[model samples]
Target: MLLLINVLLASWFYTAHGQGKPCDYPVIKHGWLYYSYRGYFPAHVNQQFVYSCDRYFVPPSQRSWDHLTCTAQGWSPEEPCLRQCIFNYLENGHNPHREEKYLQGETVRVRCYEGYSLQNDQNTMTCTESGWSPPPRCTLVKTCSKSEIRIENGFLSESAFTYPLNKQTEYKCKPGYVTADGKTSGLITCLQDGWSAQPVCIKSCDRPVFEKARVKSDDTWFRLNDRLDYECLDGYETREGRTTDSIVCGQDGWSNKAACYERECSIPQMDTYLNAYPRKDTFKVGDVLKFSCSQGRIMVGADSVQCYHFGWSPKLPTCKVGKVKACAPPPQLLNGKGKEIHKEEYAHNEVVEYVCNPRFLMKGSHKIQCVDGRWTALPVCIEEERTCGNIPDLDHGDIKPSVPPYHHGDSVEFSCREAFTMIGPRFITCISGEWTQPPQCIATDELKKCKGSTLFPPVGKPAHMIEYDHNTNKSYRCRGKSEHKHSICINGEWDPKVDCKEEAQIQTCPPPPQIPNAQDMTTTVKYQDGGKNINSM
Candidate 1:
């Protein structure tokens, strides 16, 4: 029975070639191996065999390679592997599917090791005839991207840069801030998928509620540096310790307590070198407190104060004498003059106004006020030297300006009116108060001077009429013996016509020189030969 089975298998392999004819070898798809271990297949048309990659390169595919068979229709669903890719790597390149060679169209994958990452990563390589383009190159570890990773209100302990895989990176909230869970710091391990979670640094609040006063701006949420403005209603003011008007927003909440109470004020007094009039110990709200400095002390602040809903309108003035610094005469300015001064020595708070001459514009500060005996600033008088004269009108076009009478170093542009075109410069500049070369506006399509007859060969027109500053060509055939093949018009000039001459016509064949054994004959297909001849013998 075993001998019979072997004979039958050998016969099947040769049967398809021609009813038991044999072949030198069994047929299989090129670049694929025939796995005869299961059973042998015949090498005739339509014969098939199971195949695999034996010594060939391994593929990254998870599925099995195809089993190929011979078919009359060129191996049903033919797959060819003509070109294979060869990739080379220097020491330390880590491709998961490293191999000496790869079949064309095969793909190989790789990943960076634990702590390193890929720079300009080309980790996935595809095999091509030229080679594996850009073999997988990766740094030895993992890293986090600052641009790709963001932690709200928190910053990384490491410089915003790459780190090794599994390396722990810490995050910290800025001062006066903490995490949403009230933690001030956190850590995330660098991973292939990036940091696991981003740290959220929310505003820390010991208490959010207020007593005896409602929140301002109707704000329900708060953050660092945010402000809250308060208003006291019904002629009442905030409590003595409570701040009204505007309170600064701090990490902990408002910087001060807030409360509403009836308005009241006490007589205000300066701490030094100052006193209030009427010598009252206390005064009611809305009363005015006039202040004067002691002798030899110059008043440097509000001369008087009114006790308003908020409190004294202005803080009490101070007295000082020797700390004052002086400034020399103000810098001289063209086309400007300063007002006269009464005192020989200019004192703090004294102001001098400057006036510019007619047609001149003031540029800098208009007044030089003395500050601590030093002048605040001197005014500058800038002359309007940028006046450009009226731009001349164009005959067939009008001119427009970005502004009027274009200034010096400024330009005025002109455009052709309807159906007109400019013949020269389209814009003119104001150089030294004068306009530069201006272009003339001419009727559109009329400036081109090509004669119609010369361009058309006494026949058809170009696709369109010839015009100035245009290029166009027209096909033409001469009406007479010599013909023009093409005519082109450019910039109002027509190129010289290309003359075509008809090939000379021969009416008849000349006397045939006699060959020793041949004779000449004539035949005509037109008009019974009409005595016109072509040699035909």
Candidate 2:
């Protein structure tokens, strides 16, 4: 009964002095005890720690003091109060294997799961007097390399070199191309290594090919409406021309009808205004085809083609739009504009009128037209009025159909004296009011010094053309003449002298001369009208 009273009194004493902190329960903070204890303030001693060498720690080799005793001290040697941490609680995403326990000075290695790592990343948990050191958390710092990201037929939206975990981007096809299924592929997701899947685009059709034909495009792949231009192989030809040799691509693959044939020319299917006259279905060797354009169009290629053994001499002709006015795009005069102001087009034989700006004068032809698919007399707007200079005289000659007061581009023909040869151009043209080099009446070479001769043709004879050179001699044969005719060249002139008689007829004189003759009578020389003969009979 006295012991119970004493126990109650002691409890009251400890509560009053310790502020409710039980001595046996030593205020362990962020720490665990190494052993069990006993205490009641002013009575029994308290074990400050819980310690066991079983699976967590190795016991000390020697001890100098006993434990669990109280003598003017709080507890007995809580020193040597080593804690055990054989196994640890999981912190999630970290790996801890092999080691079942940890002792003082021993390390506890741990690793985070793939794609995850600890904040400190020291990868170790250590046991100490205080207990296992504060553990690290498993965090994410994922990164992906740009080189690892490969997308086919498409590109990534982000051009960055690296991406964090969960980063996303898009892929798109190039121009004039599309993806299969006619829908955009799902967005790309960054995985542990790289992007999820590569993308590809497929077109409706591929480029077309022919047996003996070729396309001029640099690429071999094509899509809808992509024209596949081609030409026939050498020694071969299509039914018509180059235009007809092409096929188009569609949803139904290639729409080509170009076929190569041997040695034949057919009329091509041409646009409106283009004509190849009398075009039969086909033309054989030696047949000719004439190509022309309508009133408002012009020929863009050969005027005609002939069918040879190797097909058409030329591929074929094309008639293009010929809105050719004096100037299709009227000249930009400094201060003038056309009455009918169309920027680029004009029809054949179309006329254009122009008015000069105020204070400016008009030069050249006022009215211009599209003549035969070409411009004629394009006028201009000038700031000043213009005139031409004087006409220079021609040496030893007079102008024929002379144009006095010669203006720009005015011209005149030149005539030489009776026996004179013309030198230089026969016509003198004026340019910018100045005449071109005037022609001269060149003096003739005097044949009087060289002398001359005449070859007399005999009756029933023919003359043969002969060639002559200066100071040279040549001979000719006449049909009825008994002898060859000889000629000499002097001063760029040829003189021939020959006397012939029929070999079958006698040469005897019967009052030799202009006698009564048969139908084939002939004479070597004749006197001028009303002129007496040098010698009379």
Candidate 3:
């Protein structure tokens, strides 16, 4: 019987193996050996083998398996069996029934549809023997939040609205109105299907109204809308408001035509002066008048007077009686030609005499008297003529006599003695019988004029390089770039060399080329740096 059983077993093993089928078997050899349809097994069934067999097994009676048997079953293992199955499938290019399998602590990725983003985790959980836990789910993400809208002095249809992600709000201003900040087309932010903040609508001003200068002249007056128009009375002009028919009325008051009146003053007249005559028909506030005395008469007070609000400026000045008087008497006298006496006062016709010591001579008159309450003449004392006649002449000198003998009223002049130049006065006068000090002369060589050199060259278009005289002005121009240049002397100082090619040449150019509107050209270049660097280009 054992022999017959061995033959049958052997035949069955060969047949099953040839069919590429999998099966399970009972333990063998008194628990020391075991066998399956295709292979030998141990007493204890290996869980891994059992899983594999279960995945590919068919009912034992339904035999007739072929090389494609495993694929035809469409059976795939779970967990441990699937891991090996997957390996087999990869190695042999076989298709497995199990779509996917995750081990413990493993994750599977998940994705959302178009137009949507995952709000929850986008990955899956692993399957344990306890069964697959719920996989991570994906949710759409929202980009915008609800927002509020506000209008100045008004209300909004809705204060808030939920906006989809990446969306915006369009704004419009009310009729008869404009935007204060943003225009009618304004926008608000939408974050995660919500708005960041409320959008605002602001109020604006209307057409401006002009106020006459009398009403808005003061700076304090201004329109509520931050705009104002200004106008002035007839005969006045506007100084500011131009466009927009409005002005900002600065601290200096209304800018446009401001009211004002013409200023005027009444004419003035003159007052009289003491002891003076008027030279004109009338006088004004500042007129000046003069005063004087008749010939043989003298003035005693101010000679001029002015007209003022309070009549003449310094009160009318006066002119009084006049006379010529002699100086007070000297200390001493000699020869006693006449007795000396002191008088309280002298009348019109009073006479007095004077004399000098023996060797000295005097100048001026010897006797004087009063006439018309004034001194008739000046009196002086002197020595006799005999003393002056005896004076001797020095070497290199000569004694020249007067054409008319020297008398009390006569004067004489003297010149240098030959080569010797006299060093004192050259004229002398006779007074009271004696001649005054002799005259002196000076050398002629000391009277010549000074000689100096001219600073500028006399030829070659004499460019007054510079002149010491402050009043002299000069301009220079070169013929060409090689030598000619344009230059000017400012306040007696010459400018550094300038290129002539860029400037007008002297005589060769017709009066500086008749610069058309030169002044306007100056204005154009005034703020410009000038084309000095043109050559670099």
Candidate 4:
């Protein structure tokens, strides 16, 4: 009974002094306690002690020893000591941070030794709680070193020293050389081992040497299959009866000879009643022939005609027997006014011009002339209306549903079909009653597909493993509810999300009954607590 009373007294003393129960002795790895409690099995509450690390080791705080206190949950800092890391013996690299050992939270710098380099070109490392951050590793250099590249008859398009893997550069040839692909310039790529191809310029066709001709292109060199267009000089024409001709560069030399012969006009045909001076079988360009009426006839039109590259100019005169008369007046035109107003009479071969009013477009010739005392046909003016009628169809694309008479400032969106990729703007706008440049849909192997989210189920099927092609649409409903939604796959991305959500329960009722044989019926309803209540019908 006395021993029981003593235990009860000890519990009461602990509660009164705000002291917690004693804790079991801790066993630390690679460390020991600084103060030895004389033959004590357990530590008392609120007892303080200092712990220390062993050789080549340190506490988590990087100190030789750390303080700990007993608490209700046990000793503070359950694990206090950690092993120290040593920096040495790095292959193909040298450790710049000279230290015997390192504790947690310590950092250092390392560099590659001569004839070696870092794997990613990084040089810094840190000593984390576990070990070195980004463990030090050095490897042999396999990168392509920068150097001056020289081409015999070509030059680099851009000036740069560094060339990463798979990078490309262009080189253009000088005047008399061409690339292997029959082009003036060529591209080369930096491969994993070395450059993909060397820059080279090969001999091509020599400079053009021809008389009575001027080449269209200014390039002095021409590659195989290259065409050169040339035009004949004055008084010269190609053998094909044309003023211009083209020659292709073949493997041996130019395919055709660049030769042009002197031009000659055919003999002129004369009228039976007219006499022409300087009669000849053939005439040269720029030659002129004079005409005179025969006997008592009069001459109309020009008296002489000159030979030009495009046949005769003006026209040969004609012999007539009657006198030229004056015209009464020019006929009026619709939606247009003539420059010659209040003119009662017009002479033969006289001309008058007409112009349409605002918002009108003139059709046919805008001038009228009196020929042989008769006016030519008059031009017509049509109204100018600016408005788009119908949306043009796309080659491999489709547009969102839209209605037209599309006016200014309206826009429409487009999407490519399956297995096709859009190349330009997705949305086109109407400006000044005309649609902007529409995008092109080019066929491609990399077609975009969209996977439906679990929150939305495609119509008539589960969403799992369901893939939608570009520009396609699908409908869904909120789990078990009546509300429906839709989504479209545009450019591999889904837009205007249709998500399923938990719906709040709502109460409703049928329509109120009507009185039999009633003359007039009126219905009144009120809502309370999310339910409809009918008062009268």
Candidate 5:
């Protein structure tokens, strides 16, 4: 009975093993499979096995070891582990063979995009344990070389032998030469093809010699298109019938001839009762002429006149009737008494004297004389009276001629002490028994308000306001700009830090057409292709 029971169990085990299909062994490259301790041959359904990668290699999950399951079809993970060197994406480069994972020690040819180059002119990348060796990066390529440059009468200021694209260098010309823009020194930039500008020096012009003219310049050298102004000397004029003219310097020489000629004056028109000697249609400069009155008339002005560059000098004399009578008694002097006042009738050229009363000042000459049939102008005396008391004292200031009581019509000047500002008029006068308003000497520190003025550009029009207090704000729009600018008053000043500038006009463009694989275009777009780089002027 025991032998029969053992046979039946063996049959049952064989039948169950035959019914279920088993999975083939997994052959993973660069990896090893770990078997269970039970040593089951031919993996069965629902069976799980552990696999590990070689040194520097990992599974798809980036782990050293991972489990694989056996399903009814086959092993869940067909390939367990692989070499883990991933492909390095180059920012400005292209790879011929792109893959998700690159095997260790594998190399691929690469090239940089336009206007870029790899360091050391290398063109290959190798996969290594750490990653891609010699990291795939491209730098901007240099386009200009110093050896190919040739400057005539000029030299570069920098010491560099090679320059990258868009690099700038300063150049200076010789003493007697200048750049195209009339400057002795200029800048040049390295561009895609070559240098931005030619380093050639142009000839400069020297100061010109003038005849009968003069200029007020100390400089001996001038650049092309430079203008020089000159004024003709006395009694000289230019061909343009003017005294002043300008000459421009050209590439070869000065534009116009700078010279002046002697001047001539036309003859004078004489009065009906006068005769002029040596009369002519025109007179040369510095010529003189003599005049005489008619036989029965006496001269009333100068008898001679001289011709000048502009016209004649010392007007011609005039003829007048002669007097043949005696003079009357001397006229009375106001606020004074006359001396030597003798007879009622006196001969021509007789003199009389006058004196003023006490506390009265004398005006005009103290003596008068008889001329022709009339007496000369009489002297007058003005009362010297003090109307204002002692000048009012001032704080931080003093008045000149402090001695007072001040007389009527007298004035005093006021000056502030050092570091102080004076407000209102600087002078005060005594008028009609009263003094004018006096100015105040306010300290500079106390003047914290800004006087309203149009000196600042932020103030659009001339301001008539008295003053602006501290911390006041003002707003105005600049010319051609819609946005308003602001200014503030600080410590007695309207400080508009920014200057009013004309608004820059931006060119508008139509919307760009839709691109197949690009983002929407806004104001600008950065696009690159395999072509030469260009620069804007």
Candidate 6:
């Protein structure tokens, strides 16, 4: 029983030891973890246990652990102790093995040095159970140094300059010269040594010239900057100044000279109608004279003639015959006013008659006889008298009697007062103490009113068709449309609206008959009483 107990205790101790937890490995700065394990363990253990140094154990198969029985009993055969121990270790930070040191297979990064860019990969190898792969390398950056410096006016040679480090040069222009643009003091910049390029200089012109001409000297011949004197020619005059004159050749042209000669007039002439007769005396070349015509006859040519240098004058005048007889062509008769027994030639005791146009009255004798080759006295015709007794009251206008009694052959005019028109003649003749046609008083208001068929005829529109009130001088548009109805009525005669349709269908009526040629006539035909009696064969 004692031996069995002891064996049991030993087995238990082995099992417990095999079940021991993995030991934690300390991670060195810039380091990694690595691991290893056994291939087999005791059969009673079935499987080998495995663990990472920093984390918990993984499955045995993953860690290279397996199941295998111990060959000799009593004490387990230490066949390399069934499983070897595993751990982590530190390495050169740049070594590839350092990647395995990390249990999580984490990565580690490297960077370039200051003032340098990375030429290789930006990041180094990652960290694993082994250690960091390899640290990245850093390189040095390139730089330029200062060269030469240059300068230019109103311009720059190159945009920028490179220098070794810190250095400069002073800028300038030559003596007696100035900069065209930019700073006169010059410019400066830092180069390793001095400036890059150089500066330049420029030049300018001189003052202007003055000149003048003398009266004796030809102005066209004078040169620039020349001084001269002046004098007038014979018979010519100069303004004030002896040497007071001066001129210059300006942007415009030459200047300065003397005034030239001018002629004046002496004795002049008197203007008249007859041929000009100049005074018979010695006179200067430009002198002028004039003349006139004698009485009884009028001058036929230019009213006044003048004397010229060549001879007598520009024009000649002559008298023309004057009229002798007092009477001229026989005067036109007024009303029944004047008569001439005969025209051009008149004989004694020839009788003549004077008659006025219809409606006018004669105020003197209607007949005159010639005496001593001339008609007797002239006669006059006047307006005839119109008596209101015979006058009719027209609808559109009115007439009032004159204050003075009308004479036998006198007449008076009638008219519409306002807003009215006289439909008939305003004047009426007096016949046996009564008016031939009476003057009428009428209304203007009713004249504008129309009350007929609204349909206008296929003829031209009417000028007027108004009804007139005789009592009030009022007029209104007229009523009804008739073929004979006048569009307007004036002087008691109707002016009817004309139908244009007839005009469209017909050519104008043939012109009035012309006298038949005697050669063409067979016999004469007499036309009378609207019928013709044919006498021709």
TM-scores, each model vs. reference? 0.27, 0.24, 0.22, 0.39, 0.30, 0.18
Per-residue lDDT tens digits for candidate 4, residues 1-537, read 765565556656766887877655677777888776533435567777888878766777878788777788888777677767778746678754554577666776777764455555556666665677667777765444346465887888777776655668888998667898667999987776777777888768866787688875777777767888888987789887888888888766788888787777776666788998788877787676667898887665555666766666445657777876667778777888888666888876577777776556565446555655666556676665666556667899999988876655567899999978886689887655677888888786665788867766446677767787877887777657776787888666777655665546663321122233432221211112544211222
Task: Please write out the lDDT profile of model 5 over residues 347-428, one tens digit for every residue.
Answer: 7556677777754666554656565566655655677675877677778998776676677667889999998887767998
* The candidate that achieves the highest TM-score relative to the unseen native structure: 4
Q: Give Cα-based local distance difference scores for all models.
A: 0.57, 0.54, 0.38, 0.69, 0.70, 0.38
Tens-digit lDDT track of model 6 for 62-87: 34332222232311212211112222
Q: Please, what's the RMSD in Å of model 4?
A: 32.7
Stretches of candidate 4 exceeding 4 Å from the true structure: 1-24, 27-29, 34-46, 71-79, 86-91, 94-102, 118-122, 128-137, 145-192, 195-225, 228-244, 247-297, 300-309, 313-315, 318-537
Q: What are the RMSDs of all candidates, in order?
A: 37.5, 27.6, 30.8, 32.7, 28.6, 33.4
List the candidate numbers ranked by TM-score, top first: 4, 5, 1, 2, 3, 6
Per-residue lDDT of 392 in model 1: 81
**Model 1, 1-537: lDDT tens per residue?**
765586567767556446434322333433455465433433455465544533333223312455454654445334432345555553355543454656767776655554444454445767765556554455555566766667776787778576655668788987667775667797777678887777778775343444434544554545667666675553366755444556666755668755566566776546588867866876666566766778677766445665655566445657776566554555555787877744566666666767776546665445555555556435455555766667787898887747775655567789888988676777887754667888887777676755454434433556345332434676666656354466666446666543455546754321111222323221111111243222212
Which stretch of 10 consecutive residues in model 3 shows the poorest summed lDDT?
Answer: 519-528
Give the local distance difference test score of model 6. Answer: 0.38
Question: What's the lDDT for residue 298 in model 5?
Answer: 65
In model 1, which runs have C-alpha deviations exceeding 4 angstroms? 1-44, 47-70, 80-106, 114-122, 127-133, 139-161, 164-175, 178-208, 220-227, 232-237, 241-246, 250-253, 261-537
Candidate 5 ranges with C-alpha deviation above 4 Å = 1-143, 204-242, 250-297, 300-309, 318-537
Model 3, 337-438: lDDT tens digits are: 534647656543355555554444544334444434444333234444542343234344455675654555455556665445554455665655566776
Which numbered prediction scores highest in lDDT against the true structure?
A: 5
Clash count for candidate 2 is 9
State the lDDT at 467 in candidate 1: 39
